[model samples]
Target: MRHFSVFGAAAFACALFAGSASATQEPQAADILFERPQLEKLKGGDRLDYSYSFKSADPSLFGPAFDDRIGLRVEPGDGPDKKKVEVEMFSAERRRAAGPFEDMSGNPLLSLMLEENLQRLAAIFQANPRYMKTAIRLALRNAKATPEPSEGFGDAPGWRVEVAPFKDDPHKARMHGLDTLTYRFRVSEAAPGEITEIAISARDAKGDVLFEETTRYAGKH
Candidate 1:
């Protein structure tokens, strides 16, 4: 597991290592780069969104794979205090590749891959605020080493993240023979800016949250 704060033009990268594999097949990893959240100034409040780009760390090992992009939305509530905020996130296949995993339109395996990526992206977003509170907090609790803060949308003062694990049946996650059980959580936040609080969670099978560190943003408690 790895973690880092995402702010500014500097990219936040993480590697997803494939679980155990056959001797003939070497384990591979995918490098994912998360762009800083982009803030859009709305009439009443503001809308903040971000993008995630990923590729195989070793193309030869994984072959040509499609890159992915996810979009996140934050809608502020009415009134000066803005007590409620609406949060949404989604991912779309940017480019398709010609290979066994191609034509993901109807393939369950490929579709599951896309869904997993989106869920992972959402988890990162949900963990942002708490991850920002204390450098040591992120490192000790979340397994994310803190990075120097740079100029970016999420760099604003008072920004925070909160995550709550839920009790539910484990989700079945499989890709290219790699299988794992994962739990779900409800991640929300009330940070600086127009966002008073966001309510959203990655659905089961949407993503895996194993070994993820989550906590309430400092000052919230």
Candidate 2:
């Protein structure tokens, strides 16, 4: 009902992997959605991590479901006056992600978390991640977040924003039947990263789930 702000750590994507991206403008929410003071709220000696899970209705088509973690390390800011964060998302790649971040004064982990998902979808569609990213940007631009219980680790008051960017896409025919895909984001100040949980899924004509992925707060670990 009201607006709010959120993160979880991240890496750059070609430009998306390394450059910056942004969403709709709503105040507290967009800040949490894209920019946040998590780094400012946090300090040296503070770290945060989230549980990452991937599940696709058809593993053979979309890979297998697995568990992972996204971690953030508070360190000296890239500039003289602020604190910066380093992210270790995929251990194999040893990637460090922060989206649309020009500097490291604030939390960029949330940006990373979201970009990661877009990258995955891009890969599935054999399209550019940036192309898929546009959907989210459009969704956030027209979004009206709904009030909800800060689920997962954040029990504080929160908001959930849901969008189906592909629902009306004229290019739906080429999306591997995933044109109905939807994304749900839950965020609150009570959580360590402000992000409570994120869910992405798409169903088939039969109403069976086709794919699903989620990132949730698992508490300090």
Candidate 3:
């Protein structure tokens, strides 16, 4: 499973998280950053929600840019920075599908189609691709939260995460691409403040193992 050779798809997705460069400025530092709302900042078990959007740096991915929102909740912690997270849901509307041609790897072409027509003069409008951006949703609960490392994931701070598809989801059972996903996060163990490795694997309605991964924190945060 680790050597699936999903390099092309993974790299393509990575670019979407990394922001695009502007003519007058250099590229931004992070592709994605989660911000806490004013309400979540309050203490005593209050939950917080926020939205995240992703766009590809290269316009060639699709005719128009893609954007989706993910809702998240943070549990109130005793300390100022302490928090527990709940990934509520993700939705990808106007998602694209496979295209007609193939790539260098002789793989079928795929893309996320946009709902909105592109502006004739825009760069994105000119470089249309076969992929469509889809909305992703999640129903999250007060699961245990872990702390990330100080340095960073891959040498910094964060644990790896794996999310399984919901039972009601149809296509996930049919396609390999839609099965499940794993992520690495910059967080550490909650108690004893010791850096640790984390992995999550969920089974489907049929009880088959669906998602799993392992993450380690190198140093204290």
Per candidate, the number of residue pairs that clash is 4, 18, 39
lDDT of each: 0.25, 0.63, 0.28
Cα lDDT, model 3, residue 149: 49
Q: Give the alpha carbon lDDT tens digit for every residue of 1-79 in model 3.
A: 1111222322433443344332333222121111112222334333323222333223453233433432323344444
RMSD of each: 18.7, 7.3, 19.7
Best candidate according to lDDT: 2
| Per-residue accuracy of model 1 over 1-221 as CA lDDT, tens digit each | 12222220121111112231223332111110111121222222333332222344333533343433322222343443222222222233333221221111111111222234334444544433322322212221332112222223255333233333222212213222112222221111223222222222232344532222121112110
Best by TM-score: 2
Model 2 lDDT, residue 67, Cα: 77
lDDT of 2 by residue, 1-221 (tens): 11111222322222222223344354433444555554555556566777788887888888888878877676666665466665666555434444323346545644565666666666666886566666666666566668778755435688787889888888888887678888888877777657778888888888788888787866643
lDDT ranking, high to low: 2, 3, 1
After superposing candidate 2 on the true structure, give the runs of residues whose Cα lies further than 4 Å from its correct spot.
1-32, 78-81, 92-102, 152-155
Worst 10 residues of 2 by lDDT: 1-10
Q: Could you give me the TM-score of model 2 versus the true structure? A: 0.76
Misplaced by over 4 Å in model 3 are 1-14, 18-170, 176-200, 206-211, 218-221
TM-score of each: 0.25, 0.76, 0.24
lDDT for 77 in candidate 1 is: 37
